[model samples]
Target: MSFLFLAVIFTIFTIFTYFKRVFQYWNKKQLPNLQPQIPFGNCPNFAKGKENLGVELAHLYAQIKKEGWKHSGIYIFAFPTYMPVHLDNIKNVVENDFEHFCDRMVGGNPKTEPLHAHLLNLKGTQWRDMRTKLRPSFTAGKTKMMFDIIKQCQDCLVKKVENLGSVEVVELCKNFTTDVIGSCAFGLDCKSMENEISPFKIYGRRALPTTTLSRLKLTFFSNFPRLGSFLNIRTIDKDVHDFFMNLAHEVIEYREKNGNTRHDFIQSLIEIKKSGSLTVEDIAAQTFVFFLAGFETSALLMTWTLYELAKNLEIQERLRDEICDVLEKFDGKISYQSLQEMKYFDQVMNETMRKFPPVPFVNRVCTKDYKMPNEDTIIEKGTAVVIPILGIHRDADYYPDPEKFDPGRFSEENKKKMHSCAYIPFGKGPRSCIGMRLGLLQAKVGLCGLVRNFRFTLNEKTPDVMGLNPGSLFSSPVEEIWLNVEKCL
Candidate 1:
């Protein structure tokens, strides 16, 4: 009698879940799309982590675009979601109608997920206030103040590359950027350039290790957030959570008690703490995010940039010349002012970001009911809106010869000819990355330092095309980016 009752309950529950999810999409009469399965929706491939979201979404976009649909429907497990494919609609979702669609569709309860308060997870008023306060901290003055830190680390990097001589430095560029961010962001001077177990490197690895177990769990929860929520699924590991929380607390406390102040990110957080308006958990959460954001995202950007440069020698030599000319004015030191003088450096960075945005994909939530531009269709409230940044960036309509690595595509004149919203590696509208200025500063400083000193070539082992690590949220290499570098001077 007990076993029979349990089976009956399971059958009823399964039927209800199917009705709410699987059958709902069928009744909606939504835009045409690939058929969804009972549980995974149109993302069985994504659920298996078999392909990257960017590539997967781009493939979907291509198919929908071919169908002549400017906008299409997708399912995050039978929850009808909006995917903007046309230029006008995508622009409206991000820019013109931003107020109606301001929040990125990231979900986390603040009390349960304290670390989620970090800028990436923050929304609306909280995001605005924190962003305003933090914006000035990344100004040219702040970036310049951190110049010595990057140079010191870059010197370490160059020496490490010099030691490698003719041999390949697998994942060399990523480590170089890691060292740069460590010194600049955390006040931790690390030789990730040479040392495998540098504390900063170890901590970064711990922050997002991309284990098989973690990936599977994340896919399940992200696809079925409501179900996962009810089941008490937690993506952040207890050990990782504790390590970051304790480290952040200790760092902040030591700096406050010792009467120490450096113009780095931690120092800024220290000021926020001293203000007494915010809690210690708030400070620790932001610091943890700063460290993670500073290292992984910027490292991947630099790695992709270096790999592209390796394959394009003419462009590489041109950029190296620009670096030389700019540094010559600053007595051969790469200063903030000197870096700014290299307009070509800005072009190269911009083009690199276009080809390989750190966050290749992003989501926005529709705040109010909104109409798809030029179409009669309305996007109902509570729909998850996905913007395929990587797809639009690589589209041949926007970029001529889309596969070509051409920094000249971003020259001032060429930029003037392009649409204002065409390039969005830092994203767009009011809710874009608050840390954009600092993120760009760190990436440019490291790239400039590398271009000024080393001549890099594609190693025999360099992947034909950069591959994404399946388990990461950010675009990361599945394998290390190997390169052969020689001292230029």
Candidate 2:
């Protein structure tokens, strides 16, 4: 019995020693890295749900930059990750030497979760090909095609706000976006704005990785992919997968059987699929990403924009005046043309995105060994690279008084002086968000309609300095952004 106990102790010790030695990668390479603990690395607070990941990541960037390092390394759960503090290096990795670092390093197992094989999770030539096929679906013309659908949703939002004198903007925006993405992406009327408990919203909450268990599963898959594969871990919940799969199959069959057509994202995919190349899973995956990316991020954008404008009444009124003037020019109608003329509104949206970008950081993997410019160090293949978007946006050198909620910083003349890659709210280069134009259009339309019809003010329930929710993958308000709303006279 004593010998058996000693053997068990030895096995545990050997495992610990292996991981500790693996953690010495940066040390052996003579690279500066943040001190890492046994398991959580530099993300102890994040893993423990005590701090927001975006804010923590920004703090890490600030720490490395303050130390006068162009680039630094850190461990993310025993994984050696590189953080680039300089935009030049960021540009080099993202664009100039794109071939050396292309894939995002995110894990996706088509066998376990076929819907996870969307444009975002795809890598190499598959991603390139998928991106090429989907490009035409999001063009300026295609966005115009869906503007009327968005406008209808905006009308619903206006009615909903009129009925609810005071409400939490996040939930309202979520409902609006649910309807918009439902119609535009999948050609279904979700009716979330009218119905308080829509299936899409209910299933969305269950499927979204916002809960503790879901996030842990996501982290497990991301950090230890081999183990995840062995267990057949799926990114999406099984019930949610079944729900989407059935709905997608139903929609495709109905369209094919009736020969009916609609100018929506799914229709564009159907056209592509008719070419006999893409499969049903491919169609479902792309549409799911469209809904996921479209609904939440755009909702967050509108939420933050309204929150900022509510706090800054002068900016709010100015924007309202501009929105009103533009609509009057188009005969008091919200159209694609009228929305374009609201330039200051656009500036406000840009600033909102800068301060609270939907995606806090963009990641890339070194696909080939590449030497750092003007340095002896070489970033070996398989190294993870992080471009800290939030950190760069808040940098004093880039945007003075970065936290002051200033929209003029995005003015045409002011923007001219900034670095090209410095303000990447939607990221930069070839791998930038394919749905940017659509996102902007939806956000602008929603905000314009809201501002033109109603007034929003911060309610007493709102905290003075609300921190972001640590659980949210996106930088979202920790609590409900309660606001008093009144119809504009």
Candidate 3:
């Protein structure tokens, strides 16, 4: 009995000592930091779904900013993190001194899950080379070729909501985007809008960790990437992996055998493969990421834009007028040129992204020791650097009356006056989202289709005060945004 008791005491003492040393990281560096609690550190109990990581970071950002710090230190489970609070510091990290912070802090085991080798997870030279190869695929010309597919999906979305009195816009938007990305990236008719249980839709939800077990797995893999990789942890489920991989193989084989070519992302990958630079698994991984990013981020952007427009009826009407006028110029068709000409539409979308960026925070790992400009602080290599995007977007100093959704803030004159790095919905520098143009086009096409055809009003089913989904890693609403819809006469 005494021996067991002594062992327990020794274990407790060891753990306490380790935690104490870990918690002193910021103080040793002489940086401002929030007090950390045991196990969870400064962050909330994210594993238990107590808070959204993005929202929690935004709160921390606000706290540190109020204290007048240009940069601050934080902890994610005893891991020391550097957060840039000022625009200049943020700029330096993402753009000015980018070479020292090129790789994202994404965690996954590519050997266990080949699909994890996509651009989002690659590091150093691999990422740069892959990025160079894929850059042309998202060029304006390439994106324009995929516009027809987006338009077709938008037409389906219009039909889906034609006479509905009330609709959950979030689900409706997701269905629209799924079909768009499915056709463009996978070269398959997902039929998500027509069929609720489409395989693409079902598997897409499975890819994002929403459940308790899945979330736990993500947390473990992300915080302890090296250990997770050593243990061969698989974040992507076997069924989901098989579904996408099989689909990719079939598509690639059909295209190669029949000399079939389509103006889509898959075709671009096929061309890249012909150069002996990419393998079947590489193609699958790239397409999977394209599909995931193209669908979810665009869908959420459309949903939030619709929700905001519903609340601000005057803004909705004005945007509709602009859409109608631009389409009229093209004989009632939404061409790429027409979409670009809708200046107010751009403002509205920018404001929406500002107010609710889909990815609320972005992270980078320091590749070499970085010294803060005009400061003695040395950010050691391998340290995690976080840019609290949501916090910066809502910062009152950068954006006056930050809570109020005003599209005018993005007007030509207004935008020029604001700090260049102050607004980075798609991020900045070479490592920013490669598919930004495609994603924006998708959202714009969907918005023009819906706004010109239907009038939306916020249904009481949606909460008055929107809250982020605690279980989701992305910035998503706590509940489905239900909106009453009526065809515009």
Candidate 4:
């Protein structure tokens, strides 16, 4: 044989041998796992949008649970991923043994991408410090302070809905949330509902990796962080980054020069900056993440809640009655206190989140070696752990008749009976969503405004059985949820 041909044969044999050993990692550790395909492993082709990451994880979860395993392992490409199945195991990973798995598996070079320094992507002490500084901003008192701003945005939504008669609720919800976050986070009047092409709305869409190429880049960057950093890869688009950074600077400059102090998040961030612990970039990064997380997740929650209410008219009417009764108690005004008084409304929102969690999976990277609770298996340091939030929420064992949209599942009595970790729509533990209270408040205000003023029914355009969007990361519907709205008599 020629020398070149011999070299090619050797390379092929070596590559095959390497992958063969790589695929046996889970089995060698004595963990149950599904057979993984070469190159893609057990994960779907996210680049081609073949399946959603959440759906794939949920399916893997179902398979493992069916086999009666407490925990199992899978692969994201050649990388072995640990998945905790039982509620106890999940609690240990997220709460009890949190120190061993404190950092998320998020990939980004903060030095290269300054915005990546935000709380969601930061690790260890950075995250702890940032969380401490931002905690007061999301406290009940602070959230209440921003209530009027949110209500003002809701008024815009109600007016827009009244004029439209029929609407794609997902888009409408996104617009409303965009305005709320814009006003609260950046201290800017977004007016997303009034504008045909709001800049915030436009850039917000660009921020997410919705397109095929962007998703591929995200997958590659996350899977190979060292190499991505070496190449100076940035997941955020340059233009989008510039827009937000410039906007942040503008807001800070205007506020400082005019001696203006607002009751919103940016003002809180400014206080941190004055202490010399934060910079303009730091402020921008935080507010950007605040906008991204606040708007998208809250919008999805509102969208799903409205869709469910539209589908179940009886439940819808009951929730509407609760809203009316609560507002009447508060002298016909929707206050933060009034929203808290709407018990049925809270139940309905909880049920909606259980059925369709905004972010279906929570990821944590093992920072230290840890043994599984009550098991012989040891998760080595640097292992990736995935807590399947969707899987847990929809488990028949935890919630009987998982497919049903019954708000009663979240009643005070029923919730007490459930495992604390079983229904974590916003996740659990210290690393859980920091802005959860604010996000919930945002959704509640928008939902209450709609449910009180308008009656919704599923339009012919909406699919009878909603399917998750494979192209998007969040648990969004495959198609826009169109609703027919009529003014409540």
Candidate 5:
């Protein structure tokens, strides 16, 4: 009798396990995603690199559009994610119902990591408050205060390359930018350009996890963030965390005691602290992000820009002429006004960003459950929204001859003629990058200075095309992007 009872219990457990997935649902009244299985969902096969995120999402978007759906559903693990297939829906999701999708899904626990609640993780009210406080830090007038500081870093960058005497590697660009950002962001004179393993480079390299498994786990956490509470995923490593936190505190304290007002990002954060609106952790997190977040992105942008200019000498010489012309007016200093007037240089950067956006995709979570704007579909709460940025930018419909490196696509008139939402290198909407203006300014100056002083050529070791290196979640060149540099006439 006991055996019979046990058999019955086993049967019930099996039935319940099988049927519970029936409760796992989507509004099939509208466009449903390609059906997912018991657990892994649409992306399970992606682990062994069966596909990259951008390729998979772009394929789904194309299928949904072809099927006449304005929006569609997909899955990350067992959870549903809304894949916007129409431009109107894209505008609404990123702009109109923005409050419902303000959070960037990639958040860390502020309790454990008070420094983790920088702009990227701050949700709703917290994000709004911080955004309001930080906006003035990047204003044109405010950025101008740091113009001399930028030139100082630029000089250091040129000296490092000149000393190298035609080095072939592009990681050197990253090392240089790390030094520039280290000095600019935290008032710490990071001599990374002078020394390959400079403290900044050592910590920064360690901060970015160096394994494919770690990258996949980080993405999984972002997709199913609730599970992240139980996992050890972090936006930054511990030593990196300690280094910046202590540095921020010291910098803030020193500035306060000395009455030193440098009019930098940290200065604004100090004011927020004085007003009792932000915590010590908040300031540290923002500053840390300013280094980690902005540093690598700017590095890759400059690296690719240099690579493209090397491949296209006509474009490079034209850009050099403009830089010289503009600097001739400013007594050879790459000033804020001069940087702004670099129209061709700006186009080259824009075209480069379109070719390779550092963060290939943008993710958002549905705060409140949302319905498709003009459809019967309803994307439940806890759904991930993937704006496949690089995919969209590379779409042939949006950009004819998308493979060609054409800076004219971003020419003032040509840019106006295209769809406003089609190109968003910095992203679109309120949750967009707050440090964008500063980043672009730095990128323009860095590229212009190099183009004006040197001519770049693809080195013998460089690949025909940049292969997508596995384990890099960021859009990066697979091999060393080696370029030959010669001092210009």
Candidate 6:
């Protein structure tokens, strides 16, 4: 018993010594940084599920801003991380000096988690090559080709919402986006709008790294990759992996056998696969990412926009008027041309992204030792750098009355006054979101469909001050946003 007790004591002491050294990293480098706590470091709030990672980082950024530091250090568990508080540093990291911070420091064993090999998680030359190849798939011409699919999904959304009198908009938008991404990305009729319990929806919810155990696993993999590799951690749940793999394979096989093809993302991957450049796993991983990103990101954006519009009746009325006028110009049809012409709608969407960006933070890892621009401090290689979009967006300096929902902030004259880096809803630079165009198109279509056809008012059930779900990586309400919807047509 004494030997066992001594062993435990020695193990704990060793861990303590290691973390002590790790936490001293920024201090040794003489960089401005927040002091870290033991074990959890500066992330005890996130670890305890008291706040989401984004909110936690935003609070840290606020502290750094209050101190008037351009940037500050934070610790993700035992790993030393950098948080850029000033817009110039953020621009340097994400844009001007992007080469030094090219990698995102996120990935799993592609052999074990094939779906983890998608563009979002890929690193180095593989990422560059894959991004280049997939570029054409989301080009303006391709988005136009996919507009019809979105139109059909919008029709379904309108039909459903017409009957939904006072319902949760998140669920409604989730269904609409699932069907839209399903048809456009996979040529599958997910029928999420028609069915309450769609399998795609079920798997989609499970696919997000939102649960406590999943978040813990992700944190471990991100901070201590070798340890994660030793344990062979997967980025996806097993069932989600199997579901997408089988679905992609079945579709690819059918397309090959029947020589049937469609103008969709899956068809683009099929053509690549035929050239012997990508494997079945590659196709599955790419399509899975398409489905997951397409559905959730746009759904959350639309839901939040609706929530904001519901709270501000004047803004909703003006937006609806603009949408209606533009649709009239295009013969009451929601077309690519009509959607683009709705300038006010565009501004509203921009402001929505500003206030509640789907990705509240952008993360990258330093690949080479980088000197802090014009400073003697050297950000060592392998350090994680985070840019808190939420903090910058809500900064009173950037946007006057940051808490208020005002689309006029994005007006042509107003946008010119702000620095380019001040607003990065889709991120900025070579490694920015590749599917941003498609995401915007999807969001515009869904929002236009609902706001033009239905009048939405905030239900009493929703809290006046929206609370966020602590577990979600993407921004989500603590609970459903129920809205009272009445058909306007």
**Winning candidate number (lDDT):** 3
RMSD of each: 3.3, 1.8, 1.4, 1.9, 3.8, 1.6
Candidate 6 Cα lDDT to native: 0.87
Model 3 ranges off by over 4 Å: 1-9, 45-47
TM-score of each: 0.90, 0.96, 0.97, 0.96, 0.90, 0.97
Q: Model 6: residues >4 Å from true position, as ranges? A: 1-15
Candidate 2 TM-score versus the reference: 0.96
Error of 4 at 93 (Å): 0.5
Query: After TM-score superposition, what is the CA distance of residue 2 in candidate 3 from its true location, in Å?
Result: 5.9
Q: Predictions ranked by lDDT, top down?
A: 3, 4, 6, 2, 5, 1
Candidate 3: tens digits of C-alpha lDDT, residues 305-416: 9999999999999999999988898999888889989999999999999999988999898999998888899999989989999999998888999989899999999988
What is the C-alpha lDDT profile of model 1 across 361-403, one tens digit per residue?
8888787898766666677766778888888788888998877
lDDT of 2 by residue, 5-118 (tens): 999999989978977997888888878877888777777778889887788889999998889988888877777888888889888888899988888765557677888888
lDDT of 6 at 224: 76
Alpha-carbon shift of residue 62 in model 2 (angstroms): 0.4
lDDT of each: 0.73, 0.86, 0.90, 0.89, 0.75, 0.87
> Residue 393 of candidate 5: its Cα lDDT?
80
Query: How does candidate 4 fare on TM-score?
Result: 0.96
Judged by whole-model lDDT over C-alpha atoms, candidate 1 comes out at: 0.73
lDDT of 6 by residue, 123-180 (tens): 8899998998788888999888989998888888888878776888888888888898
The TM-score of predicted model 5 comes to 0.90
Top-TM-score structure, candidate number: 3
Sort order, TM-score high to low: 3, 6, 4, 2, 5, 1
Q: Local error of candidate 6 at 33, Å?
A: 1.0
Tens-digit per-residue lDDT, 133-167, candidate 4: 99988999999999999999999989889866789
Instruction: Write the residue-wise lDDT of candidate 5 on 73-152 in tens digits.
Output: 77765556777767777777789888778878875666666677788888889889888988887887877776776677
Q: Give the range where candidate 5 is weakest over 10 consecutive residues by summed lDDT.
A: 19-28
